[model samples]
Target: MAGLRPTRQRIALAELLFSGDHRHVSAEALHGEAGAGGIEVSLATVYNTLHQFRRAGLLREVTVDAARSYFDTDTSDHHHFFVEDEQRVIDIPADSIVIQGLPDAPNGMEVTHVDVVVRVKKV
Candidate 1:
């Protein structure tokens, strides 16, 4: 499991996040889910926990725009499909696409990983 101390709140949120199939969640949306599930928690708490989880390598943060972000439980190497009409994120396996463009990293720097978000909308 993740290395953080097993606090009650963290445990509850982790259950909500990892118990089900891997999926993406925004803080506000997750806070709503917690409330509906009868878990007493706050939005700020959710945000903080999410940041902690990201730092701990338990979740991957995906930013769609300045105003919205999502935490994905599936931490494997993969890209994404941002479904605009539904405002949701879906996983895209990394091998399915080939990236051709290239720019060398600056001296003393190296690229760790790449994140690709393909925006899609229904016509």
Candidate 2:
């Protein structure tokens, strides 16, 4: 469980997020879900809680565009398949792709991780 104080709204939101199979969801999508589920939480609260979860290592943030971001329930190493038309994301196993020929880190910086989002469209 996340280490933050468990307020009633946080508890309800967390249940919706963590009580099922791993998924990718944006704040707007989650806000809609919360409303549909009759959880009277505000959109701002959802966004703030999502950022808190991401900082607490309970979720992974995937950025598809400057205007959009999605949070993943699965926190392990992996890539993604972004279906542009549907505005959805699917997980891609980490072993399926390989990265190479990267330049060395600059100064004291180090490369710890790489996130790849392969955008796809239906034929």
Tens digits of lDDT, candidate 2, 1-123:
568999988888898999999999999988999999999999999999999999999999999999999999999999999999999999999999999987999999999889999999899
- Poorest 10 consecutive residues by lDDT, candidate 1: 1-10
Tens-place lDDT digits, model 1, residues 1-123: 478988888999999999989999999999999999999999999999999999999999999888999999999999999999999999999998788776999999998889899999999
Q: For model 1, what is the C-alpha lDDT against the true structure? A: 0.93
| Candidate 1 off by > 4 Å | none
Candidate 1 backbone collisions, by pair: none
Each candidate structure's TM-score, on Cα atoms with residue i matched to residue i, is 0.94, 0.94
Count of residue pairs whose backbone atoms collide, per candidate: 0, 0
* Local distance difference test values of all predictions, in order: 0.93, 0.94
> Model 2 residue 23 lDDT?
95
